[model samples]
Target: MLYSDIADVFDRLEGTSSRLEMTSIFSDFFKGLDPGSLRKIVYLSQGRLHPDFYNAELGMADKLVLRAISFTAGVSESKMDELWKKEGDPGKIAETLMKNRKQASLFSEPLTLEKVLKNLTMIESAEGRDSQDKKMKLLSNLLMDSNPVEARYLCRIVTGRMRIGAGSMTILDALAEAFGTKEDRPDIERGFNITCDLGFVAETLAIGGVEAVKKMKVTVGNPIKVMLAERLPSISLIMDRMGGRCAMEFKYDGIRVQAHIDRDSVKLYSRRLEDMTSNFPDIAAELRKQCRAERAIIEGECVAIDKDGNMLPFQNVTHRRKKHGMDQAVEDYPVKIFMFDILSVDDEDMTLRPLGERRSKLNETFGLSDMIQLTTMEVVNSPEEGEDFFNRALGKKCEGIMAKSLSQESVYRAGSRGFLWIKYKKDYEEALTDSFDLVVVGAFHGRGKRAGKYGALLMAAFDDESGKYCTVCKLGTGFDDAFLAGMPDMLDEYLSETHPSTVDAEMIPDVWFLPTVILEVVAAEISLSPIHTAAKSIMKDNAGLGLRFPRFTGRVREDKGPEECTTVNEIISMFEMQAQNKA
Candidate 1:
């Protein structure tokens, strides 16, 4: 297929903010693509050359892209830089400048999707001396062959800023529409959840049909999407939700790691699917030594330890990820792994098994050692017992307790957040029971001491019923100078000219953003307000719930997506609970 065809679809998708329309456009575009090229098309649409787990990025900086655009458009670097400053986006600058170029290439060839994808792969794989120049030449060749419209998207993809407002969920929706019925979506989602690769799933569905996708299973070395937990306020509510009996495990405030062990070979992945095998080589050696199974996939928490063998906070363990002096850091801050759950063993899928069965297998598969042990847990039948366990976890310097369902149907639902598990943290006893994970929807300009930085962020809660983000709070406190200074670069890709279709807001700020980044926030209380849009008309006519004195917790929920953030219904439930307590 011609690359221009894909570019036209990108233009249409970017012009509209509606996710449904974007999905429809993507579905139609997918239908026209060759089955063999579907995988490349999906990756390119995501501004990637491979699945996220592969992590082979284009590695093109803004200056590099600008240089390539200038080389192709017959413009100076200074002139392009000025245009970039005014346009605020390199993609747009390329589009505007390329259309009015003073010089034209003597020879041009029609660009194909295959050539574009292959050339981009070469750019990514380029290495060693003068590699930057090689990458610039390759990108310049593509720009010379591309028209102004195609150049716009090409630059965006190279610069890692394909702002089409479509994420993995939207692409899955499109894939279901293009290759199978809507009823087959769950199977498709399951395939993605287990394999953690949308491109592979798309190719399988396109070439081998839905049955191929349904046949996908957990494999060693491939990272499965980690399961997530929802938050509730009190032990009574947690016990009530879990049928009065549940397993309570200590929630460690450390890195969540999934270890894939196949005999002597072992690998580790973070909760966000990042490869961490090299960072935690000590843990990998420990797993290889202690794991009894020939092949297994187990999840655990890796906590840093002090010289006296006491657990340290998460900040201390984060230093282990640094590239330099890793050996020294590992020795300086030794770590231990507390195993929690097992997903697979010897080519058998355990994700469908109940939590009780999985826990049994986890206990049977590993031998205890000083470097590795099972998480501290207890079976509780009442709220009082659960609260006592929570206090015990706190006494051990842990974050809190995880209340997990022990029902027969409580299987691991990968890439999902539901009531199967609930997290009760230390802050629950404060004004609010749990801190909310909200999405950043807008930002207010700073003044006075905060000049040149964002003063406050407009936050929102996800409404799953309507698939919209509703404004709930304005978060301005708790962010230190470092965080404030990094806000622009962190949120640059999500910056938008207007509110996204997925967002519903009452008060506009100096800037809007797509609902992408998730932040943990705490508030003095939940109150009804006429200005906020969250839970509107449910509690009272035309009044929505808002956060009072909302402040950032200095924690970015990187493991979560915007759709998985705290929900409006959860907020309403908390509000009602608070009112009952007052009564």
Candidate 2:
């Protein structure tokens, strides 16, 4: 296929805002492609060359890209820099320059899809001292033959910002529409949720249909999306939700970890599916040392501990997130991982089994070792018993208790949240004391004491149904002077001048972000608002849920990803519970 055809689709996607229209455009583009080319096209459209877990990136810096643009398009470096400052995007500047090139290259030729993919792979593998020069030349040569519209998309793909509204779900929807009927969407999505590879799933569906997609299994290397739980207002509510008799486990205040173990080595992943194996080398070593099974995939909590074995706050483990001095950090902050659930053991897919059986496998595969142990759990039949368990957990400095159903249907539903598991905490029965994990989507400029820096941030909750970030509250309080000063260094990596396609908000800010950073926030209550888009039209006609008097909790929540933040349904439940308390 010609490169211009693909560019036309993305260009139209950037201009259109409605998700349905985006799906239609992608479905039309995906109709007549071969299987291998379909896979590559999906990855490229998502601004990626590999799956989500890969650590390598294109490594193209804005300054280097500007140099390449000026060298190839015959624009002055001064002019390119000026345009970059005003537009804040490398792709836009390239689009403007490529429209009127001052020089024509001798090697220019018509660009093709294969040519784009091959050149980009070469750019990604470029390394060593001369990598920057190599990247500049490779990209400049590609630009030498690209049309104005094609030049826009090529630059955007290299920079990892396509500005297309199509998310993972959008692509899945289009694949189902193009390959099969709407009934096949759930199976298609299940394959993606299990494998975390949409490109591969699209290829499977296009070639072998839904049955082949359904045959996908939980592999040892590919990380599955972690399961989630719903929160209850009280112990009685939790008991009622669980059919009055359930199993409860201590909810530790630590990092959520999912370890993939083979006979030899082990890998750890955060809740957002990021590779944390290098950061927690000590934990990785422990898992490998204590394994009793040939192969297994388990989930747990990694908590920092004192020399006396007392648990530390989640903030204590944040130091391990640094890129350097990891050996020293491990010595300074020791950790213990409390194992909870098992997803696979010895090549058998344990995800389909009941939680009771999964727990049995977890206990059998790895017992109490230096850094690993089963989570503390018990069976409770009444509210009184559940409350006692909850109190014991809080006394041990834990957050609360996780009440899980003992029913036969209590299977591990990966990448989903529901009432199969419920969280009962100290704040639920109190005056809304539980802090929320929210993502930063937009920010406003500061004044007076906070001049020349960001004063407030527009926060949002992850609406899983829509795969978008919806605004909730503006966080301005509970920030120290040091945090205020370090805002730019923390948030500039996700800076965007155009409104991000993944975020849905009625109110705009001075600056927009790509929803990458997660922060811990607390609020007095939830209220109806016209400005915020969270829970929009779900409860009321036009208003969405918003937080009243929201404040930061002084923690960055580095362990959690933006998609793992609090959800729209959780906020709506909290709002209704608040109303019930008032009555």
In angstroms, give how far residue 327 of model 2 lies from its true place.
Answer: 0.8
Q: Any runs in candidate 2 off by more than 4 Å, and if so which?
A: none
Distance (Å) between predicted and true CA of 351, model 2? 0.5
User: Would you list the clashing residue pairs of candidate 1?
Assistant: 428-433
Tens digits of lDDT, candidate 2, 1-583: 7898888888899887778888899998898889888998899897888877776688687788888889888878788878988987888888888887765577777899989888899999998899889999999988888888888888878887677868888899999899888999888988998888889998999899999999999989888888888877888988888888999999998888999999788889887777899889988888877878888889999999999999999888778787999999999999999998999888899989988998888887885876777889999999999888988999999988899988999998888888989887887876563678999999999999999999999999998778789999999999999999999999986788889888999899999998889999999988999889999988898999999999999988876777788988888888888786666
TM-score of 1: 0.93
- Point out the worst 10-residue segment of candidate 2 by lDDT: 426-435
Model 1 over residues 1-583: C-alpha lDDT tens digits? 8999988888887788687898899998888777778898888887888887885789888888889988888888789878877776778888887789765577888898888988899999999999999999999999898888899999889887787767788889999999999999999999999988899999999988899999999999888988878777689988999999999999998889999999779989987777888889999999989989999999999999888878999888888777789889888889999999999999999999999999999999999999999999899999889989999999999999998999998999998878999988877655577778899999999989898889999999988656679999988999999999999988877776656666889989899887879999988889998999999999999999999999898888775667778899889877876675555
- Residue 321, candidate 1: Cα error in Å is 3.6
Alpha-carbon lDDT, every model: 0.88, 0.87
